[model samples]
Target: MTEDVPGVMMGFMENWQGLSGTWRVTLVVFVLVLMTAVTAFIVSRLVLWLERRFANTNNLWDDAFLHAVRKPAMGMVWLLGVYWAADAAYRYSEAEIFQANEHLLRLGFIWLLVWTLIGMIKQGEQLLSTPGKVQRPMDYTTVSAVSKLLRAVVIITAVLIFMQSLGYSISGVLAFGGVGGIAIGFAAKDLLANFFGGFIIHLDRPFKVGDWIRSPDRNIEGTVEHIGWRLTTIRTFDKRPLYVPNAAFTTIAVENPSRMSNRRISETIGIRYSDARQMAAVVAEIRTMLESHEAIDTSQTLIVNFLAFNASSLDIMIYAFTKTTEWVKFHEIKQDVLLRISQIVDSHGAEFAFPTSTLHVPDGIELSGLDQQGQTS
Candidate 1:
């Protein structure tokens, strides 16, 4: 195939022998460009056709792979065309200008190929992160982190290949990089710590993107927006964005509320001392209410008791878990349960307590007041 290239060019030039040198080169360039354009058009159409065919299939991976490659493949086609044109137009010329141009085209093709591979890696991440598609779907944060690492690997490999193509000594470059890396590591120790923290997070699988996490040691409590190499972005309940260092997750005790099987509803409802007589009945009604509540998780522990006697009231405790971990739904379920409890207490003629005190004086001590005088009341 290599030997045939020159022969093909020679035969083409022979056909154009009647044209001057400048006109002959011009015509060759024009022909190569036109051929490249036509080839690229055909390739693109073929890809689109394949995409349409894949769309009808049950295999999700095939469709994802095709979608990932489509744009990159088109770019590659153009790159190949340019490389071919450069090669054909300068096949016989030994000029430095032509050689440099050919080199640049080759480099462009290499970089474009690398870009395509990186794009495919991104698509693979998306496929893995998609819920219900894979047997074991990865968390979005883990997927994003892994994708970043894969892209870095792709870029590093491409750079090495590019360096080698440019006639640089690979071993020497590696040695230099090793020494430089040590110094850079020391200089960016915090950055490296955050990076490793992210790596540990990926491995540990503590919390994932979109999970509601609260750090007891920190003021951060919200849904995870992104997990990057250096920082993790969280969107708070108040709609404020919080950028926290990845390393912070390593030291903090993070609570993943999203992973909870049930959301807790714990409260102490105090009733007036006068309602003490109805406490047993109130407790029984609340217990019944919790047991039959649709949103409450019956499988979990449910407690409704007249547990304590306060200074001026009877304390009734309610502790239960909701079936859902959703923030809104959990609150809704909790509110409904509380309302029903209030109604039950109201039906039992039991009033809720307020801070109150009553004082009494013995009959013998009451006679000390000034007789018929406003001096002391």
Candidate 2:
């Protein structure tokens, strides 16, 4: 066994020295690949460790960063490993493909960086928008707006750098863009209008994601789901998705019922004319009930008064606001209030009115001579 070891070492060295340059290059490439595999494994393990470590912290930045870096870092490592391997091979042949290795590497680097940033932006947006995920979560609309804007900027910058890396002069491109922009603007005026309209919406913030909005000018009534640069997506009450161009919002009047501090309950109730004496008492009691009701907003206007006299009944109007603005809850409160009003009217011995007619017969006219027959039989 000891003699076999010496022979094996001598033969291995002889074979190694006898190999041609191409074979040596091939071996080098294989070694490089093996090293790349090992390095990738290490990176993956490290990322997992850091992810676990950072997961315990309340800060969102580290988590986002780690998530964004994983795939891009892996891609970059593989890219560099292959580039180096190819460069080593090209050193012998001076291949055309390998000549542009630096440019390719630079472009790949830019792409990976953009990818990382976009991933980070998405993660951060999610982290910030979710309720209770952070100490002070932001509204989803605002977070989405900021994230989309950042992603756009990152993509644009990456494209510019990519162009420059390809030897395209930035100044010349800018000059041409300036001239082409006017023509593009004229051609796509409506699209541009929508884009700017969305921008205005972001700035003014009349409504946001999850807001219940309606437009009197157009048939647009829904809850906003997503506010994009071109279109804002809304989920209708019937569960249909409605996509509206942002430009439409600029020309229309929108009502955001979600933002209302309180829901108003305005109704006119009618009762028989016989109940006229109880009107004042009913009104006073209803007003007093509203003033003390737990669900009513007494800070707002509350009026229970006789509005007008109808043809068939005496009309009373109830004008009050509820403390809650939730649609279902408001209706429940309204139901309770209406039921209480009915109880109040009943307590005062008043009944609701309906259409009725009256007949009159005077003295004793002996059928007025026309009831039996027209021929006077």
lDDT of 1 by residue, 1-377 (tens): 52354347556777775777666656666776687688778878888899899888778778777777777677776766565556556665655666766467657877877877787887789889887678788767777877898899989988998888888989989999999999999999999999999888878979888888998788989988888888888999999999999898888899998888888999998999888889899999899989998888889999998888898889988999998888888888888998998899899998999899897767767555656673665
Task: Provide the global lDDT of candidate 1 against the true structure.
Answer: 0.82
Clash count, candidate 1: 0
lDDT of 2 by residue, 204-322 (tens): 99999999999989899999998999999999999999999999989999999999999999999999999899999999998999999999998899988898989998999999999
Instruction: Rate residue 291 of model 2 by lDDT.
Output: 95
Quote the RMSD, in angstroms, for model 2.
Answer: 6.1
TM-scores of all candidate predictions against the true structure? 0.86, 0.90
Cα shift from native, residue 241, model 2 (Å): 0.2
- What's model 2's lDDT at 135? 81
Model 1 lDDT at residue 87: 59
Q: Candidate 1 — which residues are off by over 4 angstroms? A: 1-11, 14-18, 88-93, 105-109, 132-137, 361-377
CA lDDT, every model vs. true structure: 0.82, 0.87
